[model samples]
Target: MTVLDQRALNRATLARQMLLDRADLPVADAVAHLCGLQAQEPQEPYVGLWSRLRAFDPAVLSDLLVRRRLVRTHLMRRTVHLLAADDVLAWRTRHDAMLRQRVLGVYRGEFDGVDLDELAAAAREVLADGEPRTNAEIVSVLAARWPDPDRRALGEIVLALVPTVQAPPRGLWRTTAGVRTVALARWLGSDADPAGPDGDDPPGRALVRRYLAAFGPAASADLRAWCGLAGLPAAVAAVRDELVAFRDARGRTLLDLPGAPRPDPDTPAPIRFLPAFDNAVLGYHDRSRIIDDAHRNLSVAGARFVLVDGRVAATWTVDEGVVVVTPLRAFTRAERTAAAEEGAALASFLSEGENHRVRVAAG
Candidate 1:
């Protein structure tokens, strides 16, 4: 019945995403609250966390990886996400079908006539010994059984077939290492939670709730886009009674947890630096709330952006100890000052305080 204009949604997004003000939550709690950071770029989560959490320590995240409290896994749209180990275990089984389908979408011809269930079992066998293996290594072992299939295709299918974690030294802070994966169970010392016997509630119902918590007042399509799962309509239906819905200006129905934060439309938002693929911009079907439609591609293009007034206003990069900002729109003196302050802090964090130089490029 109520229409949430873009600015209203923008400020709400900023509040829910911890960008409106830096939060002092613990790193583990922050990871859980944000529903996990997009972590395909291993070092990027450190920056992502730095922008949100107050007094964030890079070692705390590294320790999470080493301690198995958090895991770098292929989940949620098949991207490598640094998720809470408990969340991954509870949600991984529900994502299996979507994961398999997505990989097939890209390599369907290559896997024709190959029984996927059989492929899954074989991939599990290869990974059962507890040794971490690269995608190439796993694919090579399976080549004997499916000799004609694309090796890359086979490798990707193996990841989809099994609950796997990209092992440490890869996602560890400031560490550059090749991806080596181990079974999620082995690495976390816990088994995937099995779907219940009743099957009354679907696998993704919890995901819908979690998504709303972090990226809520969103449409069903946005939920699907965020998780890459198509079967959640039933999950949403199962929980429809528990959610409240409103229509956006476009008449798209948005779902929200009744009590979640929806900050005032006029709330002042600070300039914050976001890491590449940060979900605050990508987790919506309609991203106009946080990024202009024209610049939407930047979120997926792996371009780190600067948020000014709760919207993307500049693109940033690092060169020779300098954080360079190229504005998409002319920034006012105050916005430029704010951007500089955040950029300098980001530079120090990126270079471990060895450099804090930031340059705002002429618009």
Candidate 2:
């Protein structure tokens, strides 16, 4: 019955996303809490972590990769994410169907008459030896059996069909490496949970909680957008008794954990730099809390952005050694100073303190 205005939701989003104030939480915990960072670009998570964590050490994230505590895998929405090994192992089974369907949507005609289960078993055979393989290598091995789908699609489909993870060095901090993958079980040393006790969904109820903790005060549509899972209405319904609900300005219902922090609408938010495909902007169907509708496409366009006053105000990229900010709109003097200040820090972090120059493109 309570109504939350856009500013109320905006402050709540910044609080939940750890952007209002940089958090002191551990890197691994931050990754898990944020439901994993969108990591297709690999090195982007370093900047993602740098913006959120206090005293973040890139080496620690690299250590996580080498230690098997973190993994780069195809999971939510079938995009590559840097997730905790435990999370990927626990949640992979739940996302298997979405991953398969998304890849099928792209390659359905080519894969016509192909038996998916048989293909999964065959792909597993290729990865069973514990050696990581590129998508090309895996597709080449399966070419004789299923040659119709091109090599790229064959590898992508197999990655979806079988639980697989891109191996280490691919996502290591400041390290550039090609993607190589092995079975998730081999990498994690265990199989994913088969299904939840409630039904065929594993951790859907828990996902609702986790998602709210990180990106809540959200609608059911937002949850579906975040995880790409359609079968979670039951999961939400099951947890309905435990959650508190509010209506957004648009009159859409928003559900959130009762104890989660919903900061005052006027809480001051800092200028922050976000990586490409950052979940904070991309995790919801209605993204007005952190981004305007007119600028919504930027989130999916892989544009790294600068958050001025907790809203997207500029797009940024590091060129050579300088941080370049191209404002989406004219910035106030104060906003310009904040943007340049944060941009310098990011450049220093990225360039190992050797470069901290920042350039602000007009308007």
By lDDT, who's the top model here? 2
Q: In model 2, what is the error at residue 254, expressed in angstroms?
A: 0.5
Judged by whole-model lDDT over C-alpha atoms, candidate 1 comes out at 0.89
Give lDDT tens digits, candidate 1, residues 114-183.
8988998898899898899988889888998899898888888888988899888899988899999899
Runs in model 1 with CA error above 4 Å? 196-199
TM-scores of all models? 0.97, 0.98
In model 2, the runs with Cα more than 4 Å from the true position are 197-202
lDDT score, candidate 2, position 119? 96
lDDT of 2 at 73: 91
Cα RMSD for predicted model 1: 1.3
Report model 2's TM-score to 2 decimal places: 0.98
lDDT of each: 0.89, 0.91
